[model samples]
Target: EEWMALRIGPVVNLPINHLAELSSKLDPDFPVVAVCNSAYRSSLAVGILQRQGFQNVASLAGGSQAWIDAGLPVYGTETQATVSAAPQRHVHLAERISAADLSRLMQDLPGTFDLVDIRPPQAFAEYALPGSRNAEIADLLSNPGYLTGAGPLVIVDRDGSLAMMIAGILSQKTQRPIKALQGGLD
Candidate 1:
């Protein structure tokens, strides 16, 4: 499973090839269902399959997380729902500089902004945007000046969760504006 295998091995060891093989075995004209824990992985897999000529693939939206949320029963480790409240900083800062505006700033300001990738080291190793430096959220929170640049900070992750969390934290800690990538790298 992605949860366990990815933690202890290289990404090349993932079953992406196996999934491709299985997807190939299916009839392109017929419907196919792909699912995973939170739908993130399954959505990515389905997109890959579609790109590889599987026209009838569909990803289960919300995946097993939604299933569990509906009070459905399943055998195995229980899926605990961890809910969090939105941070006010994120709401306020967006008015100052929208994510789209930030992209323009990347071009306009050049070295004005700093890019931070606050994902697990494994995920960071697999895929990272250009000019991004891997910085753990905890470390960044503790050492704010570590990645300081001339202007505001822009943060991203595999999903936008960590980036958003860091943005909120940094915003509360310092007066500098923070923004998380509109959508994650996926």
Candidate 2:
């Protein structure tokens, strides 16, 4: 891919959701190569960054998979992480818990599960479930152990898609049960 072949030295791992908070920290004129497992999301990120006044941002044409396929180097194993093919995995019923079931589970099993609200703090503050705790996706990615030994860690988000993907990524990192809210709280 033309984009991947450019060989940027450092990679800044940014989730699409955290763009607003971190955008101020990024130099708008600096060259940036946004990447994902597939290029679709990264391509969209290019537009978002551009709209936010980023001047030289571009998306990897085929994303990290293509970069890996072409034998390009990936850096910072400790902080920068990637899911090989998370979405393609077969999702089991237990991987997503319904809101109703989650309610009952909390009632019946009390502290058997940890509810993690991945939405932004303002949204979470406005309306979040009784026991859910607010967290950014970056935090969970940086510390997979946070999801460890917490009964089943239940990730809650606005739509659940991001939550589900995060659950998939964290599941690969830890043996703990990671779940997303089914259909989310929408």
Candidate 3:
């Protein structure tokens, strides 16, 4: 009950700009500790503060996970806090495709389209759509050499999720028309 009863000061949960504002109010030599759920966000906060010329800002090493793991109490309400939304980087791809449509696409492959398997290397080696070439999704972002410039590029994965992710990356990387094989290798 004492663990639950213990109350701590409110966490300085604010956007980067607010943190900068707070830093401006404090003496340049004063120390400040940034805390977050897993220290990841706090590490980001530390970077932001340091860039703003706050010379004494530090991130709490273990963060809130360490506090909870140590059996210490959490003082605040579980209600939502104000957080600035970050811009999303990944592209949104189409959802699932039908089995009938997949079969129709397969019959027309190798001539009208280029089948690029976007699954992991190990998975591709085990089993893949016949005549499909391996092009790991990660590699597509870094090395685009394996991709052909000839036909429409169709990305195939074990499931649609990986294919969609690769399609998004490919869309940004090349001028080639990209499409994901719906339902993947299934």
Candidate 4:
């Protein structure tokens, strides 16, 4: 019963300017509210935009948690997950491709992709896909080596969701197109 209280706005992200742009669509002088899974990411968003000379951008104090804590209404649309309206600074993320397509890419397009397995090495070793190279998402983000190569960088995980989420981050981090394997190994 209490869970139905999530009536809020569409999930939006930023490099500040995009947030401003999205805000401008509403009203050029409208203030931008940046919030993340929590306050930290939102703080970074607001800070970056301000530093970049964007004015009137404010990070939602305490973010969604704060709103929820205050017992505000949340128009939770559980079906709408993942953000599509992000700036160019964000990694362009794709939903997913089938396991069959993945197999084809491996066999047909050799050297075209990296077939990055974002799971831990231990899980990867247990039952890795045909030609996947274990590049844990965290490590890949830090190393930058994983950012190399051409073609579509397909990210894999045990399920589709984690890979999808990581794909967004990886794409943003590398400024390249990265995809998640749909439905993972399941």
lDDT of 4 at 125: 82
The candidate that wins on lDDT is: 2
Which model, 1 or 2, shows the larger TM-score?
A: 2
**Model 2 over residues 37-142: C-alpha lDDT tens digits?**
7798889888888888998988988877898788877653342466665465544333988988899988999888788999999999899998889999999778
Give per-residue CA lDDT, model 3, range 116-160, as digits (tens).
Answer: 787778888899776678875567667766355776677778767
Point out where model 2 deviates above 4 Å.
1-94
RMSD, candidate 3, Å: 11.0
- Model 4: residue 35 alpha-carbon error in angstroms: 18
- In candidate 4 the C-alpha lDDT for residue 19 amounts to 56
* Model 1 lDDT, full chain set: 0.68
Question: What lDDT does the true structure give each of the candidates?
Answer: 0.68, 0.81, 0.68, 0.71
Cα deviation at 143, candidate 1, in Å, is 0.4
lDDT for predicted candidate 2 compared with the true structure: 0.81
Q: Number of clashes in every candidate structure?
A: 0, 0, 0, 9
lDDT string for model 4 (28-129, tens) is: 255767765467877877766665556788777887788878887666646556776766343355658798888887888887887878787889889887
lDDT of 1 at 90: 42
RMSD of each: 19.1, 17.3, 11.0, 13.2
The local lDDT score (0 to 100) that residue 13 gets in candidate 1 is 25
Candidate 2 lands at a TM-score of 0.51
